[model samples]
Target: MEPVVLAAGTALVAAMASDAWEAARGALVDLWRKGKPEEAEAVGNELQRARTVALESRRTVDPDAEQALIGFWRMRLDHLLRERPDLARELRGVLEDDLVPTLGAGERDRATTLLGRAEAHDHARIYQAGRDQHIHGG
Candidate 1:
């Protein structure tokens, strides 16, 4: 996934759990309105539904559900980016100036980490801070 698209998608999902969801959602809808006016209403409705799902997951402490929602939005944003390549910068701006700032400290930090890791290759081996060594032959 493109980094900006991943960041924007993650930020969008995180924003759904924030107090500023309405403002964030409005900006998202407006962006879509400018790029593809016909899909604006549908996007708005989907955002609302996503918000409901996000809130429910948060309330229930269902990380899996929230992650699923994130994946759903990631795919949606990926499609949108494919259709309107020029919107990448705009989406990044929304993440930096709007969505991220709206999150609480913990969520903001986590969202940042999520954004950073969004570009990670699935097949690549990852080694964390702790000292550990492994040899693998596949």
Candidate 2:
């Protein structure tokens, strides 16, 4: 998954739990409307339903449920981007201008961590940790 897409999807879900949700939702729907006109309304409705579910999970203190919602949106956005590569730039704009800024520091941190990854190639060892790590090897 593209890091920006992952970040944006997580941020969008987090934004659903924020006061700026309408704006974030609008931006998303607009993206769909522009890229996939036939699916705009359906996408808009899905966004609303997902937002409701996300909010409910947060209200009930269900972190896992909320994370699941994020994953759902991530897959949806990933598909959308794959189908309409042109929308990737617009998605990035929404993330930078709307979704991310609207989130709190903790939510922002969580969104950032959603894209975490570490890769190693041939003869290249990897020491990976979310926060801190030490590696000892030949």
Candidate 3:
């Protein structure tokens, strides 16, 4: 379980570098450029907190650490979703189709269920378009 946790955390951190941090920085920069330095700083601080938590978490094997890591990822995802819903949808699909399938059985089931709930919540107010497509023609 420790190995599995390490592997998952590492993979997730790598993805975070490419997705979460990059997007957060871009948004922060945009905020800064638009005369919202406080907002930009707040976002940067949150991102730093997330990374600090992850780095410290990698040194231990506590079950509570897993939830902290998960919370970091969830917050990152939520930030991205709010800033760019279309990209968030694409990223969610990528996670569901690729990353989730590579996890252990229990983790995979949990991830799948979570993704379903996320999708439903994201589209809660919108009407469906068809059987295969989401309400937004997604």
TM-scores, each model vs. reference: 0.79, 0.80, 0.43
Taken over the whole model, the C-alpha lDDT of each candidate is 0.83, 0.86, 0.47
Per-residue CA lDDT of model 3 for 54-123, tens digit only, reads: 5566466454765666655555455544665555444544454445544556555555443333145653
Best model number under lDDT: 2
Return whichever of 1 and 2 wins on lDDT.
Answer: 2
* Superposed Cα deviation of residue 133, candidate 2 (Å): 10
**lDDT computed for candidate 3:** 0.47
Point out the worst 10-residue segment of candidate 1 by lDDT. Answer: 111-120
Deviation from truth (RMSD, Å), model 1: 6.9
lDDT of 1 by residue, 1-138 (tens): 887777777788889988889999999898889789999999999999999999999899999998898888889888888899998888788888888898887777766664543334878755542235676676
Candidate 2, poorest ten consecutive residues by summed lDDT:
110-119
Off by over 4 Å in 1: 114-138
Give the Å error, residue 114, model 3.
Answer: 1.6
> Candidate 3: which stretches are off by over 4 Å?
1-60, 117-138
For model 2 the local lDDT of residue 77 reads: 88
Give a tens-digit lDDT track for model 2, residues 1-138: 888789998899899989988898999999888888899899999999988899899889998988898889889889999999988888888887888889999988877775555688899866657767866674
Q: Which of the numbered candidates is closest to the native, going by highest TM-score?
A: 2
